[model samples]
Target: MPAPHILSVFDQDMDRLQAQILSMGGLVEEAIRDAALALETRDDELAARVVEGDKKIDALEEDINTAVVRVLALRSPAAGDLRTVITVMKVAGDLERLGDYAKNLGKRVPILAQAHRVEGAAASIKRLAKSVRLMLKDALDGYARKDLDLVRDVLQRDVEVDQMTNALFREFLTHMMEDPRSITSCMHLLFISKNLERMGDHVTEICEQIIYLETGTRPEARPKGTSTAQVDVPYPGSRT
Candidate 1:
């Protein structure tokens, strides 16, 4: 057992780590919300801001990584304390990926703004974005509060995000088939939808980490909706 003073230091370190994770989560949630609104409102400026804000998320992830390494080296946390530190690291990585997806959505906004409007597409995307944002928020809450019920709810909600993505995939395909000119815009929308779907996946990962931290084992695989695997268009800026 660690001395009382050492335990106090570990607790303080853990608290700081948790605070950083939550801060990163908050920034990612904002990015998703703002990216969706920018798409809906054709607000290029807001989208640009989302893109720029990704740097802060990346920096937070680095800080979390450094903190995790320090804790493991200094505290040599055992059992549950070890699990909590590991979970924090995993959650930070997930949030950073979520931020990247949101930034990808933001990157497409200006291109989408200039393209001819596809009726109802923006609204559908906003709905999809909103769903994933809620999932992310609940997942973070689950982690912070150690609420297994909230974690389970987040796991279930991932299916809804998948279903939404499938619907958007079909809609984009239909628009592309009906009007060849809409292909460019619809392709961008497809990428955005995929990004949102992937965001939900990362949020589910965070929830899974929370579950593992609380329990010794991971939960069974959750159910999924129709696969949107047919549309695998890569983001333009993504590395090969």
Candidate 2:
């Protein structure tokens, strides 16, 4: 068995690791928010800024991953300690993916800015992005505070984002059919909506990681609350 002092040092290292994960999560959350804002305002400058910020989020993920590996290799963490390190690594990956989604959203902004705006599309997308951002924030808080209830709540909230995206998809289709000129802009907006929806998925995955971190076993898969049946609707430019 490790000596008491050594265990204390290990605990401290774990605390630092958790802090780093939270910090990285914060950057990801910011990226999501800014990307949505850029899309809403058609602000290419802000979009470009979000794109650049992704590098910071990526770097943080790499740093956290390295630290986790070091702890696993040097400390030889067993049981819960091992689980915590593994979970942190997984959570970092989720955060990194969220960053990528944000970057994707950013990349679409210039295209959207140049094209004709679809009435009401930007507002609805903003709402969708906000919901996903909140879920991500709660997921990060759940991880930091070790609040299982919060994690469970975040898991349920993703359905709202999915429903919003589905609605946006249907609405965009109508706009494209009514005015062919709007197709290009609406298509980009659809892509952005899909990115935000995917971010919600990754947020839920983070919640799952937290659940496993607290409980040794993964939680049972709950029925997905939202339906993607609307996705069957043909793309704007597709010809049958």
Candidate 3:
């Protein structure tokens, strides 16, 4: 049997668009992990590379924005195609910001690497960063699969990252109160962990957007770190 003409063309277009989005996602994720690894290993060269590589991310963002505009203007896609375009637009922007945060984290690695040690300040936050990375991976997989249940799961898992962030902050404050020498390093570590947590939240936001774009219905309970807007998009592929 022959594939339906409209669906086939739409699928081809979506394939290209999704490939670009996934490529950007992979780049940003690698940047984040590299920045963290650079810090952990005290590899100034790697840290410097991460900081400098942000330029490529910026260029890629411009290309993506241009491509999205071209699709919107030329194809005038409707229904789920429309939703996917909008979601990709918003998600790419969020990913760009995520890259910025990763770059910032790399910039601060020099300070943490100054003594070849992070002392006690990184203890809890390290765990938090690792968990956030895991969440990011799962959320991206969910987005690619368009598995609403999996995204719903990502929504619920966000609270764990939040709790860990809060706990780490409390512990950081305790260290600050206990010893003057710990204040500076603990403060920097605090910012680092906060950035990581925020990126995790942004990933969750992307997943929620995927849900809205794919289903035209926001979940009754939005996942953690996401507050959704209910727009009057017509349900795509729905029969009356």
Candidate 4:
């Protein structure tokens, strides 16, 4: 094939791959949102739906991997396109693991989705959940638009989730130390918080991957005085 033909094929393939990644990311976001709602509303049915969405996410991951491998073999893409191929492969895996984390969150919903919820976890966990969901949403948007500043925003929100997780753990520990009854429920609460923290870590990884794709280099912390990295994150419901 001519170079232009190969390039055209590669472009089409990249578009398909991006679509697959976005689909997986969308499922992951839905799972996270529904899992939080399930716990808060004590709706076991919603939790079940989140679990099912997780299966679709897994399938999407498998399809993405297959698509990436096909492109790598056929296109042998070089330079910027090569970086994109590599970044996208890793990003897809990170997103898949993120889907698993969301599923884990859903699985735990039934435990806390009961008449008497664990003390100190309800409101705090809700806040943390919302923060993580927002981070995921922005992180995916950053990927689509190659938006570095938006990625930085997602990283900052990760710190917020981490801080909230620590606070919640401390509060839960203090309560359990005082009251023996909180042992089982507190452990469940810990599991949920830990998953949220790990999700934040994965979001950071995906953001870094997207950065690498755009810049052909691992992301270096931008010095304040130098020009800021130009990346556009598209947010649907807020001032741009």
lDDT of 2 at 159: 78
lDDT per residue for candidate 3 within 1-240, as digits (tens), equals 344776687677778878878778887888888888877777788889989988888777888788889888867887777878888888888889888988998898888777334455554555666776667677778888877788778777778877666666666656665666777777777788788878878878877787888778875764343221211223335462
Worst 10 residues of 1 by lDDT: 231-240
The Cα local distance difference test for each model comes to 0.92, 0.87, 0.75, 0.77
Which candidate achieves the best lDDT against the true structure? 1
For residue 206, what is the lDDT in candidate 4?
85
The TM-scores of all predictions, comma-separated, are 0.94, 0.93, 0.84, 0.87
Off by over 4 Å in 4: 114-116, 221-240
RMSD of 3: 11.4
Supply candidate 2's per-residue lDDT for 152: 94
Estimate, for each residue in 77-141, the C-alpha lDDT of model 4 and write its tens digit: 88888888877788889888888887887787787765245654766777788888888889889
When 1 and 4 are scored with TM-score, the better candidate is 1
Candidate 2 pairs with clashing backbones? none
RMSD of 1: 5.2
Q: Could you give candidate 1's per-residue lDDT for residues 136-229 as a string of tens digits? A: 9998888888899999999999999998898889889878877889999999999999889988999888888888888878989899887888
Least accurate 10 contiguous residues by lDDT in model 4: 222-231
Ranked by TM-score, the better of candidates 3 and 4 is 4
For residue 234, model 1's alpha carbon misses the true position, in angstroms, by: 22
Q: Which TM-score value belongs to model 4? A: 0.87
